[model samples]
Target: MVAMVASSLFASLDKDGDGKVSASELRGCMAAALGEDMSEEEAAAILAAADADGDGLLDRDEFLSLAREAECAADEGGRYECLREAFGMYANAADGEEQCITPASLKEMLSRLLGTSQHLGMEECRAMICRFDLNGDGVLSFDEFRVMMHDGLM
Candidate 1:
């Protein structure tokens, strides 16, 4: 079933009657799948991230990887839940009350997000806290995090 679906998808994406999906073809496919015209930069980034070979095109396997990633990322609700779960994982303060992510924890999360080789400096972390801290308590409550995540803060 999966093979048949992938074959059909590949055929659809291989525009211009080409045997392979070029970068432009992949970008068009993504735009169509996402129901919006993706920016050139976004399309290029997706192609670069998924293209295993140096060639700037997506073969069947590469396209399958992109499809899987897009499938996961397209679920906004699931993404939010995953983010909430991450917040909970890092907000581990056994104070027996409502706990929040401290500046230190936020820094750790940011560092992890950016990769361990490039940890954000204290100044950067503080700035992020300042941006997200609604009540100005120097830490992020779950509500504040929700607002930051879902309420147009991006």
Candidate 2:
């Protein structure tokens, strides 16, 4: 099922009729359907993680690799795992650390996940942190992230 969905998704993402998916193509597709405006940095990071041949593009296998990780979103326990992966992807990209996600990092993640043309502002990101930051440290710890996901705050 994931295979078929990933294939179909890949086709939609490959708007240029090319066999592989480029960062721009991926962003354009996300921006269109999900209405999210993925920044070049975010798109590049995704492609970087998925691109197998280091060609800066996503082939079938590459896209499937990402799809498999995301497939976890379907299950309750795995949903947290999926969100953890997303958090790691953006958090690690920002500072090469996994401690916590700052407002800037959250902004980057929201830009890709929201599927909205109007990307979230820093104030919004800060507010999100404020809403979820249990320790009141102005950043989202993994524990806080779990709470946000559990609350379906996305």
Candidate 3:
């Protein structure tokens, strides 16, 4: 039943029938849902968050995860919650709790997203945080994280 629902949603979004969902297709759906167009940055943020294999497209499992999120999200606030849920996926919080996106968590998540078998070095992660850490606290608050995801999009 779940798989059927997932495939149905994926089929609806995979307009090109390429066995993957592109950012453009997703953008269209989001635009309809939000009643306004989504910028390329916002679309890219969604894809970047969900594209586990780093293919720049959403395959079944990836799309299914995102679709499941959207299933519970019906409006703008729900949309934000969906993104937050995606953000939570990469949470590698130390001490078994997450308050923000720290260098260590960013390092782990980026290494996985970049498909790097080796760690993505602490210095690089710190640099990434520095670029968008508006608070200068050496970590990414959700707002900072959103800026980084939507702007830098790495």
The most accurate candidate by TM-score is 2
List candidate 2 segments past 4 Å from native: 72-154
Candidate 1, lDDT over the whole model: 0.69
Q: How well is each residue in 61-138 modelled by candidate 1, as lDDT tens digits?
A: 887776566555758788777668757855747568687888787676555433344567877877877888999888
- Looking at candidate 2, what is the lDDT of residue 23? 82
lDDT (0 to 1) per candidate = 0.69, 0.75, 0.72
Clashing pairs in 2: 34-115, 35-115, 35-116, 36-115, 36-116
lDDT agreement of model 3 with the native = 0.72
Any runs in candidate 1 off by more than 4 Å, and if so which? 1-80
Worst 10 residues of 2 by lDDT: 89-98
User: Model 3, 10-126: lDDT tens per residue?
Assistant: 776676779998889888765543346888888889899999999899998898887666655557687577568756755546685556878887776555433333457899888
What CA RMSD would you report for each candidate? 14.2, 9.8, 14.0
Using TM-score as the measure, name the better of candidate 1 and candidate 3.
Answer: 1
TM-score winner between 1 and 2, please give it: 2
Candidate 2 structure lDDT: 0.75
Write out the backbone clash pairs for model 3: none
How good is model 2 by TM-score? Answer: 0.48
